[model samples]
Target: MNRAAQAVVMFLLGGAVLRITWTDVYLRYVKQGLRPFLIAAGLLLVVAAAMTLVYEVRDIVRHRGHPAHDDGHGHGRSGQLVGWLLLLPALALLAITPPALGADTAARSGSALATVGESETAFSPLPPGDPVKLTLIEYGYRAVFDGGRTLRGRQVQLTGFIATGPDGRPILARIMLACCAADGIPIKIGLRGDVPDLAPDTWVRATGQWIPHTVKDPVNDSEIPYLEVAAWLKIDPPANQYD
Candidate 1:
């Protein structure tokens, strides 16, 4: 690819990065903590692209009357085509922002819960509240590792998209991201009691007590805990889908 083409591609990629990081769109792919780094990296790319274009233009002006000579590294039409193909990712980022991970991803992953290590068995007392809010991962840890000892006699609230269990029962689920969507793992809680039938990926806020009973995940044999939902309400998906 020519230097000009390379500069254009860099600019497009940098602009795409800045666009997503400037809004909540980035939260769908990465943790909130990484926003500043992404912004800095985008700015660097843009600056580098701008500098490159300036040098290319200066060189053209300096040699306007001279005969052109091919650089040893120059690739023919085939290489230019391949270089242009690299723009698709940048263009897609600019034109189409994909939706956050949802039930389909969770279901396809077999709804397996992440295993708690033996050294991580420590439990903390639930904070004082009528319906204590908890992430799906936190709820899972307490229910599976501690046997809901910290959850008994307390009504807890969990917010996540609904996913269907192996038995076709609705389960409350959220994607847990260690870094980004590529490394996301689904944490699911079985919904019992009088929970309403909801379609997969329907975001909801569930308030319930831990059922103290755990069922084995058919795919991985990881214990999936149950929630005796007292009440639930449909809600829009949160700004950040991962927990």
Candidate 2:
């Protein structure tokens, strides 16, 4: 495509910066292809801009010597217009710059907001009402590793995703993974009362007491009670999206 078109495309795609910087979606799926993809896109934008400039300059020179061809707009008006159009992409990027994905949203959004390898495993189980500093991944792992024993009737704060149970109850979930968020498996705590009406992708803070539970799963031989949440509040999503 011409320079103006190229510039517009770049602006639209620039939004991908948010995904790359925060979400693991591309890193996990595209893997080695990322660098090449960026390089190619960058090169295309640069070349388009260069062509637009060159054409504009040529038109200026051609019109300068010929009065018969001269319009009020001067030489190379079309090329200059195209060049100005190229600025649209840059302007679009400026207008809609990607917002930072804050780390705080981990509680409300899915485990996709946690940063892989950044998770903490040092969280020792605390007595109810204790101020526990726990990351999303650790909270998820412990809830699973301990088989809900650690969370029995304990007031704990956790950030993660919202998932639905077989009974159609909304659950506060976090996913654990060996790689990226895509591979992350979800674990959830059932929330009591009417949930805060948070949307599927929204991040929020959950402050409540944890109640350990055991439910008979017809599909499984053993009974399991996922963690039960006593109260929850909506808040922003965390900066990262994996762990």
Which candidate gets the maximum lDDT versus the true structure? 1
* lDDT of each residue in 12-69, candidate 2, tens digit only: 4454433342443344333333545655665665566567667766877887976654
All models: lDDT?
0.88, 0.50
Over 1-243, each residue of candidate 1 has an lDDT whose tens digit, in order, gives 889999999999999999999999999889999999999989998999999999999999999999998887856899899999989999998889899998887777755465757654759899997899998888998888887889999999999999988678899899888899998878889999868688899999999999868877776778789999999999999999998
Residue 177, candidate 2: Cα error in Å is 3.9
Q: How close is candidate 1 to the true structure, as a TM-score?
A: 0.94
Q: How far out, in Å, is residue 230 in model 2? A: 3.6
Which residue runs does candidate 1 get wrong by more than 4 Å? 72-74, 110-112, 117-120
Task: Quote the lDDT for 242 in model 2.
Answer: 40
Model 2 vs. true fold: TM: 0.44
Off by over 4 Å in 2: 1-129, 147-149, 215-225
State in Å the error of residue 104, model 1.
1.3
Worst 10 residues of 2 by lDDT: 216-225
